[model samples]
Target: MAEKTLAGKTVEVTGEGYLVNKEDWSKEIAAELAKEDGIDLTEKHYEVLDYLRKEQAAGTTLTIRKVGKSGITDIKGLYQLFPGGPLKLSSKYAGIPKPASCV
Candidate 1:
């Protein structure tokens, strides 16, 4: 685990940077995380992140295939929106646990 400050608040995170405590999350933290990844959050990005957060909160397993069915973005669109590791990056920004499908 590791601790970092974002928006003047300290939060713990996994070594891979997933939030350790979901309750420590905030839109400010999401913005900060996105900036670090060189992503400028737009409505499209929020659509995916918001959906991921809601799904995780409901204890649903997150997967690339599942995200595609979300109607927010298809697999290709999600990759284009997040780049690199789409699910990993979006999940982190959403402040949810790293999806089991990740890594």
Candidate 2:
């Protein structure tokens, strides 16, 4: 495990910088994480993040297509919101472990 300060709180994370304990996440931390990826979070982005966290808590198998059908955005929009990586980046910002689908 590794640690990083987010939102002035030092939280545990994985090697790739994903939060190990989702409980440690906050909107401020999410904003900071998105900043690192050059993304500026908006209400829509928060909706997507909330969706991801909910799905993760339910142990759902996360995928771009699944997120697309989430009514938040389509596949193209997900790509646009996250650029190079949709699912991976979203999961990371959502403070969940990197999904196996990534890479």
Candidate 3:
């Protein structure tokens, strides 16, 4: 485990940098995290992040296809929104665990 200062608040994180405690997550923190990745989150990005958090709390097995079917965005849009690593990056910014689907 490691600690990171996001939004000026110290939070625990996995070795890969995903938040260890979802309760510590905030919109400001998400903004900070996204900024580090060079992404400027829009309302659509928030929608996707919110969706991911909710589903993760519900213990749903997350995947790009599942997120695509979420009515938030399609596969193409998810790609455009996240670019390099869609599910991996979104889950990270969402303050959720890295999905098993991601390498």
Q: Report the number of the highest-TM-score candidate.
A: 3
lDDT of 1 by residue, 1-103 (tens): 8999998999998988889998998888998998998998888898898999899889898999999999999999999999999999999999998888888
- Which lDDT tens digits does candidate 3 get at residues 23-74? 9999999999999999999999999999999999998999999999999999
Give, for candidate 3, the lowest lDDT window spanning 10 residues. Answer: 13-22
Clashing pairs in 1: none
lDDT at residue 48 of model 1 (Cα atoms) = 92
Error of 2 at 75 (Å): 0.6
Ordering by lDDT: 3, 2, 1
The predicted structure with the larger lDDT, 2 or 3, is: 3
Better of 2 and 3 by TM-score: 3
Tell me the tens digit of each residue's lDDT in model 2 across 51-93.
9999989999999999999999999989888888999999999
Question: lDDT of model 1 at residue 22?
Answer: 88
What value does the lDDT take at residue 35 in candidate 2? 99
- By lDDT, who's the top model here? 3
